[model samples]
Target: MITVIGTGTGAPLPPDAEAALAGAGLVVGARRHLAAAALPDTAARIVLGPLAPALDAIERFLEKLEPEKPDERRPVVVLASGDPGFFGIVRALAERFGSDRLTVHPGVSSVATAFARLGLTWDDAVVVSAHGRDLRTAVNVCRAHPKVAVLTGPGSGPAELGAALRSSERVLVVASALGSGEEGSDEEGAEGEGAGGERVERVTPAEAAARDWGPAVSVVLCLDEARVLSPVRTVAGPPPGPAQWALAEGDFTHRDSMITKFEVRALALARLGPRLGEHVWDVGAGSGSVAVECARLGAAVTAVEKTLDGVERVRANAAAHGVDVSVVHGAAPTVLSDLPDPDAVFIGGGGRELPAIVTACARRARRSVVVAMAALDRVPAVRGALVAAGLDCDGVLLQSSRLAPLPGDVTRLAATNPVFLLWGVRPPARSEGVAQ
Candidate 1:
């Protein structure tokens, strides 16, 4: 039978785990884990360095055991650090071999150990692992949320996380080698270690934000304002109604030519349903009105503008609205490459490359894409691209007029330039499909 045992990190194996290893016939685990477990000398042992080969070894072990007599009992132990179930090897094994085929023994996860060291609780903190090639989602989570516990890997470890959070004002707490005696000790042992304890540094956000840390590092980020705690907050503005967004042009500072009219912006915001934990890209983010409004609605927004003056204006507008927006200064498709993928995207310029950028965004988007077009000639091209990328397309023409003082003590309708908004929604999976 396959048995999973968690080797409490950087510490001796617990009594029960050590007993199980003593009776084991086949021991499978990383070299470090195997060494730490201190298993009795066994004939069968598998060393796991890389992952796929380790899985292959486990599969082979199972295959060889299938022919053995049913009455014959053989103990196969798998050693893992922290809790095996948490972003660990247990999930892979369970998926490949049925969960019923194995028994899992619990041990202290690194997250638990780290928090215990700090005398903290983690029920409220978001736990994420930057293991393997999954750093993007972790980075995004840190960007969108306040309290986070990150499990680090070799390349995507604490340093990478610190670098990502450096631009923002936040607090960072890092703990490494918890339960190990090597790194001096906790406050209790500090007096004994004396001068040696001085090397064990507990860095603040400002210091950690400046340096690149090493592996075996765990980090906690506390943002300036814990906005992620609540999904949405009421901003001081007109109440939610049919007039959803796109305030009158006078509401924002713009170079007249650079601003997207309020009527069209209303539709664009509607299409781009910005919410907490989602990312939105406002390409050609002229005046930054859309990006600012999206940010107000609580979505993490990145605004890309090309011109030096336009970039400055977008920042000013965002500040005027008392919202934070990451202003990216560069041209689209090119600039977008460096930014994180979005849940929704708004293309305000670059009609020729709108199709490509929209497609790229569609491939990455978890929900929707919205593009604003002033030139009617580009609608069909953008629509075709959306359709090709498996998105349902729709468009609307918006025109609005303001009441103005006339020559004869009366009001006149001052017509504004019309705008066309094109958008697409990626179809949900088949299981989520609804009846017609």
Candidate 2:
């Protein structure tokens, strides 16, 4: 059996952890952890780096005890930071050794401690791990939400986070080497400021990126002052979805029927499946009604507009709704290449290059793509582009009408133009459990 223990950010092993180490025949951890653990003289220690070797060593130790009596085998302890199960080595260990053969003891996560030091509750904050991953998603989350926590690591540390968030208004509260036991929060305002041991301080993204913050940072809290605490609620984490979507055309500024109807936008949103951490492009964003609605639904959206007035309209609509919709003032097909690949794409206004835009979006979309067309002539080519991109193609034609009051008390149906909504989803990869 394998025992994975979380050594809190501070040193000095707890009683239970000490007991495990005292009897451990083999130990696997980083040099810092190994040096602080003061393991038994007889125990075999492997300084962790390039995880495969350490896991292999543990496997060898476990194999040697295969024929020994269960009671005769000494304990094996693997030390980790915070919760090993949370984006740590425990996953690799469990995958190699099986969950049934492993036991885990968790410590306070660095994110939790950072929030605690601020005397704030985090039930409303979205926590994202940027460790060894792109900062774009995290940056977008910070831009849209009021409060967020980013788990920092070598490549995705404060400097990188700061540079990406330079345009955003979030004040970064960088928590460095938190809970190091070597320093106390009360000793100074910013614990790790210059002491180089442990500290916490608030700085603008521009300042953070402009200078070196050293390498001791454990986590960074990106916060917008206006959204610190939500109106009293029972639930947590981004509240819930808006009560309504696919808002009325009058609710947004548009270029005279140039915007998609509420009925079509509703179906398109459902097909696009926009949600947190996903990027959706609203090409030819006229007044950006569809882009605004998608942003309101919590997806990171980039509104691509060819006209300067249309770009301003999208920005105004986004500001009016209290959401972020990055307005790219350029036409599609060409502009699509430089932008980050999207999880979903909404082709709202593809002009003469409609087919090429659809092809480009379909090629890069990670999840699905939705295209709307008022003209029947473009449907065939759009469908062809989607199907040729190895996606599952499906479509629908929607026509709706509302009752209008006339001179009398009686009412008459006002029919709207019919729109064709075409969409496709990427086929599941063969490596996944889904049948190919």
Candidate 3:
């Protein structure tokens, strides 16, 4: 049997974990964890690096144990940081040996300690582990949500996170060396200095990216200071993805009745499939109604509009809906080069450059792209562009009529203009998951 103990996040080892370590005949942990513990002189130690090797070592140790006399066998303990079950070594161990043969003891997560240092409640915050994973999802989550805790690892550290968030107005709280008794300096008003070796510092994204914050960093909190304190949330994790989506035309601020109709917008949204930790692009964002709706659905959105007024309209609509949307004041196909690749894209208006814009968006979109057009002439070109970009193309013609109050106490079906909604989905093999 194996015992997994979570520690090193400024918490003392529980008595249960201590007792397990005392009897451990073989111990496995990171160098820091092993050095911090008092292991028996007879017990063997393995410094963990690449997990497979350590698992192999543990397997060898377990195989030598006499299965019939379980009580006579010395304990095998693996030490980990924070909650071992949370993006830690427990999963790997369980998969190799099975859960029935192991016991676990959890410690305070770095995310919880970081938030506590700032006197903030983390119930409304989204916690993402960027350790050994793509940083794009964490960046997009920080962009879309007000509060986020990122578990940093090597390349995905505070500096990298700060660089990605340079354009965004966010305060990064870098908490390092939690519970270590290291001396703290007053840089950036570092706090929590007393007996605990923790240093909590606040810096802007630019400031954070400017310096090197060694291996001591425990966690980074990316917060939109304006909305850092959210209302009491009954359900956690990204605010439950907006109660309703595909809002009505009257709900948004548009110009000259120039917005995607509710029916067309509905289908476009369905194809886009916006959700937390994903990025969506709305090209030719007229009035930004579609962009606003996508943002409301908890995806990081960038609304590109050529007209300055249109950009402002998109911003206003996003603000009105209490969502964050990066409004880019420029045309697509050219402006898209500066923006990050999106998981999904919605092209509403592109005029003569429609096919070019669709091609540009389709090539960069990781999952799917949806194009809405009124002119049948552009349909073939758009479809060709999607196909050339290696996307599986599909389309629909939406013709809907809404009930309108007419003459004398009666209602009539008002026919709306016909729209062609074309959607291109990347094959599963080519598609990227949000957590990637």
Candidate 4:
């Protein structure tokens, strides 16, 4: 049997884990874990680096156990940091050796510890790991949700996370050296200070990006201070997705029936596939209706509108919906240059420059580009642009009529203008750069 112990988050090992370690004949773990533990002098040890080799070493040790005397078999123990079962080595161990052969003792997780240090509850916060994955997903999550805990790794550390969120109005709480008893000052002092070797320092995203935080970082808390303390939730993880989407035109403050109709909005939302941990661009966001709807669905959205009234309208609509959308007040094709690349693009109101805007958006869109238009002439050019950008393009013409109340208290069909909806999806081979 193999024993797994989770420790190193400033907590003493439970008696069971300590007892397991004492009887271990072969111990395997990171160098820090090995150095911290009180292993028997006779115990053989392996310092973990690459995972496969460590598992191989453990397997070899287990194979050598004498089958004749099951009672005499010395235990093989693996040590990990802070709840190995949570995004840690437990899965790998369980996969290699059957789960039946392993006994796991979990410690307090860093996310739990970090929140404890701040004296805040974390059940409402979204926790994401950037280790061995793309930083953008974490960044996008940080953008969409008010509270998040990010597990740090080599390339996806505080500086990288901060760089991505520098423009956003988020506060980064860097928790370093957990359980080490290191001393740190509370510069912001908004939240209570870190108590132990865990030095929790709060800084703006820009400040975080500017500093070179070394490998000691355990986790980073990205918080929108305004909404940090949420209403007590019955369920966990990033507040469940909105109950409804494709809100009607009356729900938003739009000028003179300029909003995308509910039918088109519903189809556009389906093609866009906005979700948590994604970035979406809404070009020519006329009423910001699409932008607001996208934000409501949990994607980090940027709504670009050229006219001053349109910009104000978009912001107002977003505010009314209580969803956050970064409003860029400028025409598309040019303004899109300064924004980060998007997983999806929605074009709603590009007039004469429709084709150029579509080309610009298609080239940078990582997943799909969706264009909704009323003009038939612009379809060919937009299709050509999507094809040139190497996207597998498809389209549909939507014509719908809704029931209207007549003077006689009867219902009649009210025909809405037909709209052409085109969407271009990036081939799978070309869209593996980001993770959601």
Candidate 5:
């Protein structure tokens, strides 16, 4: 049987953890984790370095166990920081080896410690991990949401996040060495020993990093007031039906020839599925109609438009609707590189490089892609590119007409231009459990 244990960040093992470790024949964890736990001198230790190597060590340990020896009992123990199940190794192990084969023992998570220090509740706060190459999602969440708690690693630690956030007005709280009494002691005493031996109060980002944090865990909290600006418009309950989407094109102020038609825009919005704490790219955002609608739905939107007049029109529409949109003046593929990875992308122009832009967005988009085309020839090319990027592709040809009053005092259908609406939903990663 496999036992997964969480050595609380900065803290020693609780009594129960010590009991579990006494029975362990083989222990798997980082060298630091093994050292912190006072285990029997004879217990076999397997050091975990990087992620791949750590996983390899666990596999090798299991393989070498003598299952056939009737008199021998082999108990494997895995050590991780914070709660093993939360952004730790337990989920990976359970996904790989199955939950039935293991038992989990959790310790106090760093998130809890950070919140405890600030005397705040975190049920509403979005928690993100910046471990390894996963910092982009955390960065985008910080950009779009008012409150976020980031678990920082070595390279992408608080300094890196602070540099990214210097422009924005956010309250940053960096708490290090949670759960460790020694690290906390140094912080408490850093202000100088007092007559009554009073503990030091909370410190800022610079002060926290200047001290030596032994066996540390750091959490960065950013707070902004702009996130709650728009009170939820729909009634305080779940949406009624799958077809009930808010903010139709009639809701926005758009120039006669500039706006994407209602039906096509609806399909594009559906594909984008904009949400709070995610970013969306509206390339060739002609009238800023798509960008405004996305921002209204709580996404941080960046509208890319090339023409000087088009950019002005987009800005006017955005202000008329009372939504914040970052208007970028540039061409596609070239302009898209510097922007944050989008949760979804909508291409309303970029006729020739539509395929290339779609490909680039596909690599970055976490959910879906939607492209609008007036020409039939571009439809197949766009669909092929999405398919090539492993997205499930689908399209619809929309033909609509508005009511026109004729000279004979009768209403007639005034046919509008035909539009091709294509969408692609990126297949879920193996870790996400199911496709969206």
Candidate 6:
């Protein structure tokens, strides 16, 4: 049988795991795990680099055991860091060998260790992995939620994450060398010093990005200190979401009828699919209603507006909803170049530059783009922009009417101006490139 043993977080290997390691004819793991275990010099070993070959080696070892001669078969042990099942090497092994033929020994995950070091509860924190994936989503989670744990990878480490979230109020807790012998070896007699080899350094995003950290960083905990005890939640990570979305016009303080209608916002949000670990841009955000709603739905949001008054309104609206939203007081099609690419984009008001803004947003949107326009003249141009960006484009004109009280006791329908909402979705087979 193939056995996977978890080896880190300062936890001692259980007796069964030790016995398995001792008897293992073939031990496959990283060099550190092998050295720490002190396996017999005679035992065959593979220093893990490219994991596929290591798995192949394990498969060969397992093949020798398939014969009817059970006595001749030798044990194959795979050592891993943290609970292998938790984004570790066990997945690949289990997939190669049937679960029935393999046994797993799990230990404390580094994420758990990091939280424990800070004496914080993680049932409410969202956990995401930037390993072998994108780091922007992890940054979005940090912006939308109070807390999150990000599993670091080659390029998606603390520095990258910190740079993305530098403008946000969240703090980066760089938990490095977790469960290692030299965790807090030299950085002692300081205010924010760690107790041992497991050191957790809390710093602002700027501070985190300024230094060059070692490769020992296993996990980084991005936290919002203001939300530590915001509320007692029954569920972990993001909450179940608001009972309803596309809040009414009266819900937000807007000048004249500048806000996007509830009907349009609802449909826009549906096309955008804003959620945790995703970023949504509300270009030309008027009163920031759409931005606030996106943030409420657990998506990191940025409202880009050129007017000073509009910027203040967006900020006030975000504050009233009790959610953090980055308010960029600048015009789009220019400012959007520097901001992180978005999973979705909603263009509410781009004025004469509507087509340019739509094109800019479409090019950067990784998933989908939705645009709302009242001027029929802008529909073809906006649709053309999305189509040019390789997004499958479609649109509909919406006409709404409210009941108005007549003089006697009768009522009549008061029609509002018809609006056109054009949306485009990137094909599932295609991947969007990040625009510098």
Distance from true location, Cα of 392 in model 1, Å: 9.8
Best by TM-score: 4
Residue 351 displacement in candidate 1 (angstroms):
13
If scored against the real structure, what TM-score would every candidate get? 0.63, 0.81, 0.93, 0.94, 0.64, 0.90
lDDT of 4: 0.86
Runs of candidate 6 with Cα error greater than 4 angstroms are 38-42, 182-196, 403-412, 428-436
Q: Give the worst 10-residue stretch by lDDT in candidate 1.
A: 187-196
lDDT of 1 by residue, 1-436 (tens): 6888876345566676667788787888756556656676753888856668877877877777645585554578987666778777788888878899888886677666665665655555667666565666666656544556666666665566666656666556666545553331111101111111112234544577567554335334344343334334354211132334567667788895678877788788888988755788988888888988887776778899888988999889877876668888987777777776788998888757877877777767777888887788888888888888888888888787988998889999999888888888988778656676
Over all chains combined, what TM-score does candidate 5 have? 0.64
Worst 10 residues of 2 by lDDT: 185-194
User: What are the per-residue Cα lDDT tens digits for candidate 4 across 202-259?
Assistant: 9999999999876577889999889888898899887777889888789999888999
Residue by residue across 1-436, what tens digits does model 2's lDDT show? 7888877466456687778878899998766667767689999998776778888899999889856588778878997776677667778988899999887877666777889989988889888877667777887677667789887666676778898778677899998767774432211112122235667889999988987766567678999877786777678778587899989999888777788999998899998988887788899898899888888888878889999998999999898988878888888899988787888999988778999999999999998999999899999999999999999999999999988999869999999999999999998878768675
Give me the displacement of residue 208 in model 6, in angstroms: 1.3
Lowest summed lDDT across 10 adjacent residues in model 5 is found at 185-194
The residue ranges of model 5 lying beyond 4 angstroms of the native Cα positions read: 10-14, 51-74, 95-97, 159-172, 181-217, 225-246, 253-258, 270-279, 284-287, 295-300, 305-324, 329-397, 402-436
How good is model 4 by TM-score?
0.94
Tens digits of per-residue lDDT, candidate 5, 75-187, equal 77888766777777877788777899788888777676677776766665777777665566676667655667777765666666666555555656766555654332111
lDDT of 6 by residue, 80-104 (tens): 7777788777767778777887789
In candidate 1, how many clashes are counted? 0
Q: Ten consecutive residues with minimal summed lDDT in candidate 6?
A: 184-193
State in Å the error of residue 354, model 5: 11
List ranges where model 4 is wrong by over 4 Å. Answer: 182-196, 430-436
Would you list the rank order by lDDT, best first?
Answer: 4, 3, 6, 2, 5, 1
